[model samples]
Target: MEATEIIIKCILIVVIFAISLVVAMYSTYAERKIAAFFQDRVGPNRAGPFGMLQPLADGAKMFLKEEIIPANASGLLFIVGPSLAILTACIASAVIPWGQQLTIGSTVIDLQVTDINVGILYIFGVVSLGVYGIMIGGWASNNKYSLLGAIRAASQNISYEISMGLSIIALLLVTGTLSLREIAEQQHGFHWNVFYQPLGFLIFLVCAFAETNRTPFDLPECETELVGGYHTEYSSMKLGFYLFAEYINMFISSAVMATLYFGGYNFPFMDDLGLSQNWITIIGVVVLFAKIFAFIFFFMWIRWTIPRFRYDQLMNMGWKVLIPLAIANIVISGVVNNFLNNA
Candidate 1:
């Protein structure tokens, strides 16, 4: 790559990282506001105009507070646990296409960091590794509650990941490419994959909730029974890392959903705008984020709306319900594609 291109890519990388952190931070504020709104309370209005500065205040508190490593805890692994969680969460956005390429003089800037051909598999692999962070943290804490939470998280992610991958299989059969950018490009101008793979989308959405350990499936960190779940023994920024990672995962999942089911940067009536390439790219980016925010709101809404599932119910839904539906979707997609290709 030319020096200018390298510089540009580096800048983009920093920007992407900052955006992820900012979105994750704000998601916490949004979640609190949403929760308060649901419960008919004023929420954090005193901090800074409807608690706009609450995240920064919370973050500062986390950094300033004392960090504790229990005498019984494995210090190295304990530190590694939260670090790994945040690391995995941050890196998963690399393959996501943020927007169309921008033309600046002779230099063309693609909004994505890297477009690996096996982007989808890369996502699945990285996401699978995220469970290790929770497992390691909980195990290293040397607390029974932590260990139990860790085990629950590991099992939950593994069970749902199967269905999540199977659901994606149907979409892959339809799209014929594992590259996320290619999939997004194919769905340009209102031809979103949701129309073709609605079942796959639903299965994927449910699996996503499980994967992220959101409410209704948040058995791993169930506050009532586990007292704080995997990070119960953690404190200060070490604990902050784990919590921040969850929000980051939510943000990334939102982006992935927007890319997969809705359309990454594609929008209806985009062509009708008749705008310049730069303007079009900006608008597409806005449209994509709008969808992402809507999904994020839905996630928070579900967290407040649904009661946490009983463990048996959570397992049954994963194994007996979602997995089978995902399998059926794959079979149907295959048969339909076969008939279409044959005819």
Candidate 2:
């Protein structure tokens, strides 16, 4: 890459990182507002105009709170846990195709940070590493509840990841590429995979919710049973890191879902309007976030609407239901593709 191109990529990465942080912060406020709406109460109206500044208030409170480490805790690992969680959450977005490319004065700029060929595999690898954060933190705390929560998180992620990978296999078959950028290009102008692979989409969606430790699938941090779950012993910004990481993961997962199945930044008739390349790319980015916010709202809605799953039920769904269905979808997709190729 030229010097200007390299500089532009770095700038884009920094911009994305900043944007992700802000979105994660606001997601907290949005979640509370959503929860309040479901429970029929006002939420966070005092922080700023209609609670716009609630995240700032929450961050300040967390910063001002006492930092505590358990008496018998493994101090180094205890610190490492939430840091790993937050780091993994932040880095997973590197492979996502945010929008189409923009050209400026003979220089072509890709919207994504990097377009590695094995983008999907890279996502899976990073997602699996997320378990270490919970595991290390829980084990270092020397608390039974924390350990149990860590165990739950590790097991849950392992079980669901298989189904999630299988679910994506069908998409890979259809798109014939593992690169997210290529997948997005294939899905231009409403040509989304969701239409052709509805079953795969459903299974992937469920597994994503589980992967992110969201509602109904949130067995790791069951408040009544685990007493705040894995990060129970953490306080101040350490705890803040763990909690903030969850929202970041949510945002990343939402973006991934948009890219993989919903057609990232694609809108119908986008080319018909004859807009400039930069304008089109900008519009695409906005459309992509519109889809992401819709998914985020859906996530919050489901969180309030459903109850947490029993551990056994969660496992059974992952293994017996989602995995098997995903496998079947893959087989069906392969057969259809083979037949189409021969015909």
Candidate 3:
């Protein structure tokens, strides 16, 4: 790459990292606030104005807390688990098309950090590896509860990944590309895939919740049964890493959902307004985040509203229901596309 291009890529990576950190931090506050609202109670209002500084306080507290490594724990693996989880979560955002490219003077700046052709596949690959973090951490702790939590995470992610992949197949049939940027470009403005592939969207959405280990699909961390799930033995920043990674994964999943199904960064009447390319790109980025936050809120709302599923029920729903539905959506999409082309 040219020096300028390399510099730009570095800058983009830094920007995305910063954005991901900030979003993950605030999502904690957002989750609490949403949870409180759903329960008809006030959320954190003590940290700052409307609890704006709550995440900062939370971070400080976690940092100041004493670290603990269990007597029987594999200390190295225990440390590695949360690090892997956070790293995997951060990297998944690399392939997402955050916004359209912008031209500044003579140089072109892509809003995404990277636009690999196999972007969707890359996302799937990285997301699949996230389970290892949980598994390693849980196993290393040498606690039966942690081991069970890790097992649950492994099975849960593996089960849902199949459906998630199948759901993407349907989208691929319609878009004829696996590159997320191309998909986003094809879905300019209101011509979103959600209009055409509603079933695929639903399947993907459910799998996303499962992949992120959110509520209803959060059997891995069932407090009642697993004693804080996989990270039960972790304390201080180690525990914080696991928790922060969850929110970061949530943020990334929200971004991916917006990009894949809701037309990332695209808005109705966007082209009609005769806006500059930079401004248009900026608008799309903002709109994408708006959509992401909406999904995030929906996630929190569901967490508060729904009950956790039994382990068997979670597996049955993922493997039996979502997988079959995703396959059907793919077949239907292919048939319709073939007919449209021949006609």
Candidate 4:
């Protein structure tokens, strides 16, 4: 039994990791195609049919590019920077519950990699460490622009993470559990936490944008100012890691958002369908991916629609607006929960 469980876990891990990479790879293609559509231009039609093979071409380009290490830079840390970035980005998917268990005859298989009791905290910890990758990369580059970008990343993450944590606190008050699995189960039958925690969701959404360094919050990598930001000095596959890390982070962020406020794998009338367990589980996974893809599209849509925020404006919103709102949300959720409990 133990060996079978270990084998199941290993398979789940590999599948999830492969999925993350594939999604991250194609996100680059999607971003380009979406941008082209928005701009009334033909996208990468030359690469393949509808440019489906563009991501593969891009990967080949990255791999074939010349590797350059700055003469003055610390070689080891420079490499470590992007390596760490991609590593942290990939690992955050571990706690996300992709769907309910799959039952085949007497065998039951869990979709998630692991269900730690402190799943939310584990995510926070991983996200918090992600900044170090950017910071280390920037500092190791031995360039003023790179250092500045790194500093921006550190400050931005710190500012937004406070509000992010506060927003999660409000969610915790409502869910009354730290385990993500419990949170998903509680939201069965379209009883999504989003309906109850709209304000918290908004706050979290904004912070997610900031934490992932998406547009309007992409001050650290503002090309006009920092010349490729922290990655200016990186080249070849080293640079590929940083770029891939961003898309992977976005993918994981979208998945987390879906899992959290959007009810993970739960859907309306899921029970009414009267499907078999395996069928429901399969459909639940599909529904969860649908939600995740929608969120990813939203992320890309905002990138093209909104101009980047000035650093001061970004800081002010995080410190002044979102933080206060998150705190208020926590208070409101506490009162509401207390009232419901008493009633």
lDDT of each: 0.94, 0.93, 0.93, 0.94
Tell me how far candidate 1 lies from the true structure as C-alpha RMSD in angstroms.
0.8
Model 1 / residue 223 / CA error / Å? 1.2
What C-alpha root-mean-square deviation, in Å, does candidate 2 show against the real structure? 0.9
Candidate 2, run of 10 with poorest lDDT: 99-108
Candidate 1 residue lDDT tens string, 64-140 = 99989999999899999999999999999999999999999988999999999999999889889999999999999
Q: For model 4, what is the C-alpha lDDT against the true structure? A: 0.94
Q: Write the per-residue lDDT of candidate 2 for residues 1-343, one digit (tens) a residue.
A: 5889789989989999999999999999999999999999998899778989989999999999999999999989999999999999999999998888888878888989999999999998999999899999999999999999999999999999999999899999999999999999999898999998999999989998999999998878999999989988999999999999999999999999999999998989999989998999999999999999999998999999999999999989999999989999999999998999899
Residue-wise lDDT of candidate 3 within 188-219, one digit each (tens)? 87999899999999999999999999999998
Window of ten residues with lowest summed lDDT in model 4: 103-112
Q: How close is candidate 4 to the true structure, as a TM-score?
A: 0.99
Q: Between candidates 1 and 2, which one is better according to lDDT?
A: 1
The reply for model 1, stretches above 4 Å from the true place, is none
Worst 10 residues of 3 by lDDT: 96-105
Candidate 2: where is the Cα deviation over 4 Å?
none
What does candidate 4's lDDT look like per residue over 1-343, in tens digits?
8998899999999999999999999999999999999999988888889999999999999999999999999989998999999999999999999999898767799888999999999999999999999999999999999999999999999999999999999999988899999999999989999999999999999999999999989988999999999998999999999999999999999998898899999999999998998888899999999999999999999999999998889889999999999999999999999999999
